[model samples]
Target chain A: MAETVLSSGEKIFILHGIDADFRNDGRRRCEYRSMEIETKLMPQTHGSARLHIGNTDILVGIKVELDIPHADKPNEGKLEFFVDCSATATPAFEGKGGDDLATEISNVLIAAYQTRNAFDLKTLCILPHKKCWKIYVDVLILQCGGNLFDAVGIAVKAALNSTEIPKITAATLDGGEPDIELSDDCIQLDTSNYPIIITLCKIGDNYIVDPTLEEEVCSTSSIVMSVLPNGKISSVVKLGCGSIQFNTFTKMLQMGEIIGLKLNKTLMDVLKEENQFGRQRRIFGFLK
Target chain B: MPVDQRRINGPEVSVPYHIYSDFNKKSDKVKHDFSKRSDKRIDSEIRKIFLKTGIVSQAKGSAYIEMGNTKVVCSVFDPRELSNKNGYCMQGEIYCEFKFAPFSCQKRKIHQQNAEEKQYSLILQRALEPAVCLHEFPNFQVDVYVMVLDNAGSSLAAAIMAASTALANAGVPMFGLVTASTIGIYGNHYLMDPTDTEEAICNTQPDNEDDFNHGIITLASLPQHNQISEVFLIGSIDTNTIKQATEILTAANKDICPVLQQCLVKTIMKLHNEKK
Candidate 1:
């Protein structure tokens, strides 16, 4: 992640701005930075999306493969998350410097999507215990501005929505030997229930959403909440060295749920519109 | 059961079915004519090169280059104090890190730098070190990071070209611009700037024992100085054939020099206009 060195005066300014519910960029406390998303950009992957939220750029590619289901959950598929913080983001992320942050982000994603309400793993099952579709959601962090969790969550949701898993045409157990045939038609994954993470950075006495790099420096602690479209909180992780009161933690959770639901709705609507436009939609990856 | 936590779980090992099928279909579609290459390019014709500098605002100098489908972005940060400064050295150090995006190639690249990427990074550093005047900033190191957004072919050559432009754009003192190109030799025919498909075809093991002259030769040269900085050759090839390939590669590098110079000039002009 890229770090911004801010003076005491600058930090105080950001804290006061957050306390007043007016950020430096004039965004409201819960307002998000304008984001741009393009799906199906990487033709190499089964499903791919490039998202730009402020300066935090993320590219999510979902690759689907057939594999045996877990013994405990023989009928369900697997959704694995891999986050790669590229060295291009910053010199600090060179070599193994970014692996810790990458693992933390990926673990949050895995925990958020673990529940059945958030994501139905069984939907990816091919033939009960025999075979299942393993969805590898690989997230590549190109640049880090701030609010990386929110940006990565949104990108993952959009990528999953655009994912087209191959439809199974035939499956049979002939003479005790399993046989399967895949069709040309691809089935789009159901992402309506997908969860989006909302990171609320605690600045002063108030918590702000989508903190920029400068604002992030002023914040003492942050809470990351993954909320589904149904307003269900899937997971919550507290970050930073600062601690908060019990009441403030609950308040943050409530705020995250409300904002996360709204965010998910808007994301789905945008994704639907893009799909409707189909080939006519302009795709601006890094070129823009 | 105790979990083995020493090693992280890597990607699954399986054939990329979609890419394999697509590759087979594409190769089957192409006529197995030895004389004519795919994409209708002559044996010595290179792909169209698009190069630009100063793409990354945060970095001191950056460049973006697209050779057909292969897109590589290189950024050079300002020289910083060396962390392991045991003793003062006369010349500065250059650190190059090369990475291919997970979705860049037909197969998904892991997050970590694999052996091939590490090798490419060293190759790029060797190619650019000769062009830079390192002694100007002693006890400091300049970092050059190159990311391949898309890998069609000749990505190493593209990375070298992009890094040199980026270093120059950063106002780093340099002797001259460095340009690179890759040539694939299949039997007696030499293909310039072979695409991924073409390279794959040329790399396939020949069934006939006599047709053993298949390989890729990447040449990085200082065009103004008329010097070859680095030569990377993969696969087996006879000495005479390598000599011919080097000639073609050197000629290709000469042709690419002007493009690099033009891109650097444009970047400078843009900066000047912005200042005004």
Candidate 2:
């Protein structure tokens, strides 16, 4: 008896529709809802972005704080992802209800951004072993439209691209305590080569990308594919119940590859264009 | 785009950005120095308060308030079911959550509720409990979520005003409207309705962090009965300042009583018109 109580008849009807290769909303297996993206809404943070895909509103903010690099990876900076499903969105996420979902999403993000191929971490290191910047990419889920994986990934990447880490004017070693001066104007972090996630929902016969909530309920299985900008799979893991056949899984990988490449190109173009027209970024927050 | 309120600044050599690396001391001073304005008023002077009702199209009843820099949006959720396993429905429950958007301050915060937010939420719960009619809606809970979009200062007091407004908005029966405000004590001067930059901080760093503890007072009142619904204190302050702030805040909040009542009156009138 989950909170979402879809009738048995409705569930059956959804399954039947999936068999015929069409969803209830008349969307093809590979269609997404309308998406709107806005960046730098939070003037207090280093970088911030909010994305609304249907009713699902996701906000991602990145803060660059000085810290010592990892003992194992001294030359590389650090990136940590934390997701909070606030109760303002839904009562279901009250108290500790959203912890499991937060952990799942954060774990996936950590795995996806593990390698330099997906995201460059070395540039974050200010000095060899002394100090580096740890970018905390915190995601707040204001609404729970389905296909959260894709929405979060897209928002995180956009926020990262919009992140302006203050340029270090000078770093001097004086009497064991290092003194670092930051530039007046904050400089945008170079994340033009970040990764994007594509979720493939295994409907009855066909695989759907970016499935809606109603569609998510009908699907038997789904796989979240984190596709990097270099046209390689960063991580591929299955989610939800049921299983996909080997042949269909391979086909999804292929479809994901094609979609992934196109997605990367368009995303970069949007980000670059948004940055180019920067002065006009008048933040219209939720009030509007 | 509400283009009128925005300030688009060009590049500058010295922005006077205040960095707060240490705790127990008030943060740095930025552009919005209320004390040095043309009025020559001290920082503690509260702005003229106003309350409007029946503004929200969707809510049953509603009220809007402005207190200098602290702009809060509050909506009363429900006199609905108590979903949690643990519940004593004899008296209604009051749930208060205080949130400050990352962009609400000069420094952009990561999109997470830090420890301070939790403390604020608890403070809200304490301040609001007295005003809410907990026994009226038993076997139910009312939720108040205060969203601070643009935090200029004294958000907690604003939150109290918001909760009362939201309760009226939801058509929930209540004892009376409540108004709240904060008073700041700096040096020999006292300030009312301190902004985010002035939140419980010393103007200068102390030789010992524990030495300088400026006093802060938060007060919420029900005007008709002269009932003090909520009161909270933070930092350090002398007895005279506390007594003075209470008097000033009570006087100010008493004036706001009609604004909240007007909302309820409008809501009642609207319902009556609908019935007719």
Segments of candidate 2 deviating more than 4 angstroms: B1-276
lDDT of candidate 1 over B1-276, digit per residue (tens) = 012344536644544566435655755643357677667888889999999887899999999999998999999999998877245766788999999998999877777776567657766777787788888999889999999999999999999999999999999999999999998777677989988877776654354353355667787878887766666665445445656677778788999999999988787788789999
lDDT by residue (A1-288, candidate 2, tens digit) is 014547878888877776776777786666677778888889878889898987788999888899987654467799999899888877778997876567557756875676454556778988866789999999999988788889999999899888888889998777777789987888777675567888888767778888767777777567666776656555555555243443465577678767777877887887778778777766688874
Fnat across every predicted model, in order: 0.00, 0.00
| Tens digit per residue, CA lDDT, model 2, B173-193 | 766677777776554556777
Query: Clash number for every model?
Result: 0, 11
Q: Give the Å shift of residue A83 in candidate 2.
A: 0.2
Per-residue accuracy of model 1 over A1-288 as CA lDDT, tens digit each: 565779899888888887888889999999999999999999799999999989899999999998888754567898898899999998878887887577658866875786565677778887776889999999999999999999999999999999999888998876766689999999998887788888998888899999999988887578776776766555555565344553465577678777887899999999998999877667776796
Worst 10-residue lDDT window for candidate 1 chain B reads B1-10
